[model samples]
Target chain A: MAQEKTYIEDIERTLYDIKNVDKSKYKSQSGLTEDIIRDISARKNDPEWMLEFRLKSLEVYNQLSLPNWGPDLSELNMDEIVTYVQPDAKMTGSWDEVPEDIKDTFDRLGIPEAEQTSLAGVGAQYDSEVVYHSIQEDLVKQGVIYTDMETALHEHEEIVRDHFMKLVPPKDHKFAALHGAVWSGGSFVYVPEGVHVEIPLQSYFRLNAAGAGQFEHTLIIVEKNASLHFIEGCSAPKYNVTNLHAGCVELFVNDGARLRYSTIENWSRNMMNLNTKRAVVGKDGVIEWVSGSFGSHVSMLYPCSVLKGENAKCEFTGVTFASKGQNLDTGASVIHCAPHTSANISTRTISKAGGKATYRSAVKVTKNAPYAKCSVNCESLMLDDISRSDTLPTMDIEGDEADIGHEATIGRISDEAIFYLMSRGISEDEARSMIVRGFVEPIAKELPLEYAVEMNNLVNIELEGTMG
Target chain B: MNKEIFSEIPMRTWNWLGVNEATVDKDLLVESQKLDIDIEADHHEKMVVEYRKESYGIVNISIGENASLKLTQLQLMPEERNHANEVNIVLEKKARLQLVAVETGAKSFASKVNIILKGDKSQADVSVLYFGDGDRSLDMNYVLDFQGRKTVGNLEVYGGLMGESQKIFRGTLDFKQGSKQAKGYEKENVVVLSKGVRNRSVPIMLSGEDDVVGNHAVSSGKINEDKLHYLMSRGLSPAEARKLVLEAAFNPVLELIEDEVLRQEIDSYIKERLENE
Candidate 1:
């Protein structure tokens, strides 16, 4: 029998690669400058304190330098990136009020249908501003605050002011300062004390401008004895010029509360996704993070948790699929600052067609954190010899009572497993696909059924010919 | 005193985490001794080397085709002093190397071991055991660079940290693009004995070849209370039981030492230190 070579096509990306005509109400000039910051502030009608805060963040951004590690980011030029692009539509509560072009984009991405079927509330952003937002009447009557960040600043100024940029300050890193300086639109959710939002609230961000940047600020606070789940979805159309996304997420879980944040980011190949997300848990509180990375040219994202009170807990589960021309560097970090705190992290990464994937993480146990426990496990599968995968994890323990363990492995699909499946009347390509799907089953099951289905579809698109 | 960075991680990360590298302060004018060894084709040899209150600045070893060598090094430093050591090894086709290092005492110690498998079917195995007490600080970097096809590498390190001591351990397993079918594994275990001890571990695996397999694991914690209670039930004092448990942890590498006399000396050294603690 003559052997035949099997070829798997790259991602189709037709659903996410649909570009719209440029009809932005305004576009800030390319590059970072005091003038541009002032212009953005003036256009947004920001409060005086916010303008000052932006200026200070810009100062920090100027003082900071690029990260000395991770993927090569020399190709990113801020001079050619427009810091802000206001969509042609205004923030509205009715989906019919949104511009046809903007609404059509969200329709293609299935945001409205998702909101109508399962989501409790949904906020949709086109380019640099929220075009539409809606919440169920019961949720609103129950005093659950779900709206755009801009509205939160206006109606709930006190709450927004207290927590804005508090967990992730501008000084956290270079990109964080950039996000603080130029952040435009994102979601703000608050679950009141003892209230439980059974259904998940979601926000979808679509960047339709070329050579533009999206700097959204997402803030969620779950009060004492309350529980909530928030999901974030974002993507952009591919362009020749490099697009940037430097968003920031701050989550606060008060005492006896729980919060689960899930995200699936599928940006275009010409994007640089450098986002910062952090959470602080109080006594007996819990925070769960579910993340999936499937796109972007270069990405550096690590969601962090600070266990600040006794008996606090954190759980992180994520998966990354990096194909040709993509370099996704992602992981999780946890700081145990109180006694009896614990954290568990598990992740899977897949690299093929010359792509690169790296898992970087840190776990720190302070002297006060006696009896703290942390465990991290990460696995990587390289589908081709031309690809690269790395695992770098650090653990710093200061007290004898703390227990920490980390395990990592990098390997390719075993020929024996493929052969075993093929002998059972399965094609080689289908067998390979089954193995890859099984590899990510742990993380996929953690997501909602729809998102899990979407992730499976993405995996199939990434391995077209070889996938069932 | 001059200061320099030592035991750098294979891939740098966030500098704020302070795991990328370690800083060592020492006098550059101090001279170090050099040891060189070469094994010819098809030759097998074994040797024991000791460094007592002294430094081995540079050591070079090369193994020819079909050759195998087993080398054991013992480091004993009972006083406050600065020490630094560097070892580099190269292996050709069908070559094998076994290394065992036991370090007991030093006020400030820094060591780096680099091994390169330059030919096909080469293999290397390394085992290390160390103890940190008082104000002592230990920094160690170990690397296995796989450059040939079907190479194998394994590294295991075990240590205890006590008092105000601080230790940083960085172990890397790098499989190059052409190192198809290569297999590498590394693991480190640390036991914190006191409240003031600080332990940092960085286990890295970098692979560019899909056909290769690499793995690393790190575990750090306090002494097992269940085991301690079981030993105490066997008619032993608390301190004695603690020392016995640690000894059991170090026994795997200790049993590999062929020299009974050297092993006895190491045992006595560890016993005295544990008693004082």
Candidate 2:
């Protein structure tokens, strides 16, 4: 039996969809090797220690093995993945100075308009290289340091050297080791004490090179009593071949500081977005993460926070929508390593059209972390019998003095609710979409305005033909 | 995925079987026509499953018209792992069944139940007990479905988890689209052992094309500290006074067990679990 399939015809932001092959273009050899590592070090004009670090990372990457849990990644062979694709242009401050083709691609995606309206600063990376970077002048005068990682190393060497790859070391995992070996062009932000950057600093990653992998590294350090909000967005044009995104982000929140990181990812269907993000918060610090996942054929992501200091806090709010042909396994992790630490996490997910969505969470309260208070709540909606949703939440409580609670629910819409809507003359499709939109209302309300609109639109687009 | 979301998962891989036409295997996608499943439970003097009142993510079990069942269980508390349990039952027109559960607790323990009824006529009653520390939890749920014009059913639970513990209860009554003119009822109660224990009770009802009636109630908490002080005023040691209260609270559930040998085994387990310093 042949049945018609439904897909989003135009994924809204497809302007960055151009593809080309330049054999003579600046590039490195295939696969991960010493030669490839040396080539990357040369391209970045690295110092002596960085070069040695790259080689050491390559050794670790070789010894480590790929993770077997979550989505099966056996079909994604490393040999077929291009580690780096150095764009033709160096890092520039203005969009006009960039090559016309790349500039036009972003221009059509409304990047320039968004930067001008509300963003305090912006950094744009295109396939292993940052093509455009800039920040507001007033903040720079106020001692806020925001610039490319490589440039930061050369200009503010002491600060960059102090925090680079510290929270998450190369030995953390296999992909991390690989990221250390061939990482390129990401942002470095340092917020001064007691200062609050009102407008969010934004970074956008656009993958244009075919069969190439994007391994950008982001490092953010918020000093004592400072506050900052950073926004990140990623997208790629659909391709027949798989493109890999294995970026890394590490945040350090000092005493009494607060940092909120939000992300809206709309990768193309061929993308394998397996990125790592972790934060270490000092005494009395707070870290909040708001995440939305809407694309990719398969994804395995669980952002974690290590509450290291007394009275430190963490909150994670996330939403994931897995449509047909997509298997998205995403959640959050928190570890209370110190006494009086607390963490709260709430996640919502939707599975439709035979797609699979799984929410996995881990909360660990060490023995020394007495009086720790934590709660984890997860909810999933299985649209139909054919669609599947699963929730797996694990709790490890070593201290008897703490209060830890875990709750989860998995169910479908009540037939009576649908029947009532149908009796009111609403079409089945409209009624169903309305219910789902409301189902995800709490999560969408937490997102930025434009992103919230786009999320609802994606929901409508995904529900097309799923109604009976 | 977020700008930061990747945990170090132990690298393991599996050979996935994809679903596609021509090569699609139907054997991998069939629900067994013969639906026969059995579950056996064992506890060191006690086993407990509790739910908070009006809580979500509840596991529900319902009995329909003319349905018959045979159940046997044992409960004991070995002073260490105490469970305070509570459960609710509902019946309607000719829904006939029998359920037996065993319970034991160490310190704090409490139980409560609420039952409702519907259909032409029906009946049900359940019993359970607790022996533990300052442990309290609720086991509350209800099955309220109408029997086809004239049917009946019964439900009973006995068990407890205690030791500064908490329990919950859920009672549900569901009347499907059909089954006009039916009625039934059910009820449950529990005893508390120790302090610092908590329990919640929940009652549920669902009606479609219905002409039925049902009702239930649940209550749980710890032994009043003032009451313990009163026991001290009576010249009994704190441990002996605590044991007296536990024995009185568990008598209802203990009296219902038909086998004396089984009742003695549960009594010994309760004595062991409730042995506090």
Candidate 3:
């Protein structure tokens, strides 16, 4: 008898592929220009300083050149992409007040359900504006602030002006400069000093306009000795034309504070997900990152942590599954600037059906970082001969007291492991799925229960096939 | 004098990190010699070549079916100067090549080795030992490209950096498509003995065949305190114990030197550098 070859299908994106009518109240013209930036600023009632910042960022964006490395981006045409789209709705504190079509989109994504049971506060952004945002009154009374970025800029101008874009400057990269120039809606979170938020706050971004861009700026500051967990989720409906997501996330963990940031990115195949995220940890502070990348035509994201204070620490756990036309380049970066700082990064990537996955990272220990330690481990699983996986990591140490170690392995599932499982009555396909699940188990367990289930479903190993 | 890119990584990453490639100002056009060696079928051969007198050179070696070759190259410049060298090798079916490279001399040295397993069942094992002291700078790139089924490749690098020295090492294991059942491993260890030294490393593994196995590891740090204390407890001074620890790290590669005379010369050179600390 001839053995049958097992094949795993690509992520089932049916639920997220639900398209909405183009009911946007306003949409920027295709192509970037000074006039467009000025119009956006005027329409948003921009503060004088914000307008100056936007103009300066636009200048920087023009001066910068495209990255000469990583996944190909020649297909991303700024000349044809609409920089912003305002959904036909106003910001509301209640989901019932949101427009029916927009609410339906988030409702299908289970945002409402996740908000009720799993999240303490929830903010949902549709296109270029936050449509719904709400936080529990009890938490608000505890001096915790969770609201849209625009609201924070207006209500807490001093704090927002101080921390916004400080961690991820516009000159960090070309896309970052573009984001700074035309960014729209995201979340702002602040936990009071020494206060620990018991539950996680979440922000969901849905890009509904075709050939458009979503540039959100999320700023979070956990004050001294305070702790918080924040989750972000993003997705888009598949369109024939390309879409862009150049969102930026900046986090500040103050002295003795701790912050955990988690994200699940499931963009459509025609989307270019070029996102930037970073955190600055203070003395005795800790930062943890949990990430899942399941969809995107091309993605280049590396969340970074700057250990600026002595004894600061960071932990990163992430997984990327690339199938068919996907190329997901993701990893973590750490910079140790103070004595006794440490960081550990672990990631797993799976490639199938002509997909490609690359893990690229950098670890730098400055001369002042005596006794700093960093360890990086990455594993890649290729599902077939047509796929590709690569690991590229760099370590730059300026002092002998710093210790850095990196290990990477690339291979496929062992036939013996599959055979052993089959001998125990499991089917071949089931056995393979089981093995892949076990490979990503470490990263999955780091996520919230619902997000983990979502990730497993995206990976096509959930056994139930419920989320699609 | 001119500056050129050397020791480029297989797949370029973020250029801002400056590890994608190395640029050095040197006279690569210095009078260099070309040496070629060929081993016939079923034959075993061993040879030692030194670049101290030659200064700059290129070496190419090819092994026929079922042949085995053990080759050692030494780069111990007699005076302070700059040079760039290249080595290319190809192996046939069932052929094997063991290459040991010891580099310890030169004001600035750049070296690249490219090995391709072109036939089934071929294997390549490469060992590199380098020492960077004084104001010397070293840039090295080693790549093992697997093109044949069932091929095996292993790479190991050991080095120490002191003084104001700087070093960058890029090692890659590439498994091309149709190279089924190929296995490759690369390991690099750098011991920094002083505070002013700078060390950078990029260990990359690229795979296009699912059935192939690829692994790479890199580590950089100061001398092991426990081992140093143990040696000091055994009737050695602090400096002596430090030297011993570094010598132990380079011993495995040094022992691979087939020529006794050449091996001792390289060993003594390493000792002289360590003693200056």
Give the per-residue lDDT of model 3 (tens digit) for A1-468.
432234666767998899999999999899889898988888788888988888889999999999989999999999999998999999999899999999999999999999999899999999999999999898899999999999998999999999988988899999999999999999999999999998999999999999999999999999999999999999999999999999999999999999999999999999999999999999999999999998889999999999999999999999998889999999989999999999999999999889999998999899989999999999999877889998889888997899899999998878888789989999766887888789999999999998888767755642322110
State which candidate, 1 or 2, has the greater TM-score: 1
Which segments of model 2 are wrong by more than 4 Å?
A1-24, A420-430, A461-467, B1-277
Predicted chain B of candidate 3, TM-score versus the true chain B: 0.96
Question: DockQ score of candidate 1?
Answer: 0.89
- Give the count of colliding residue pairs in each prediction: 0, 68, 0
All DockQ scores: 0.89, 0.06, 0.89
What is candidate 1's CA lDDT for residue B237?
94
Per-residue alpha-carbon lDDT of candidate 3 for residues B174-214, written as tens digits (9 for 90 to 100): 99998989999999999999999889898989989888989
lDDT of 2 by residue, A1-468 (tens): 332222322235444455534332476666788998898889788888788988999999999877646677876777777888878877899988988777776777667888899789989887888889989998998788888888987888788777877877888878889888888888999999988888889888888777778888888999998999998888888788888888899999988999998988888878888888899998999999989887887887788899998899998989888777778888888888888889989888877666777776767666666667787777676554355565545444443455665555444554566678989998766676667777778788888776787777766634344323
Model 3 / residue A47 / CA error / Å: 0.6
List, residue by residue over B1-277, the lDDT tens digit for candidate 2.
1121111111111112100001112231132112122122211111233222211111123334434333333434333332333233344344443445554432222222333344345444445443334433323233444435543333333333355554433333444434443333334343444324432222232333223333332322234456678898999888777666666566666766667887777776567656742
Q: Which 10 residues in a row give candidate 3 chain A its minimum summed lDDT? A: A459-468
Per-candidate Cα lDDT values, in order, are 0.90, 0.64, 0.90
Interface RMSD of 1: 0.7
What is the per-residue lDDT of model 1 for residues A78-181, given as tens digits with 9 covering 90 to 100? 99999999988889988899999888889998999999899999999999999998999998998999999999988999999999999999998999999989
Regions of model 1 farther than 4 Å from truth: A1-9, A423-425, A461-468, B26-30
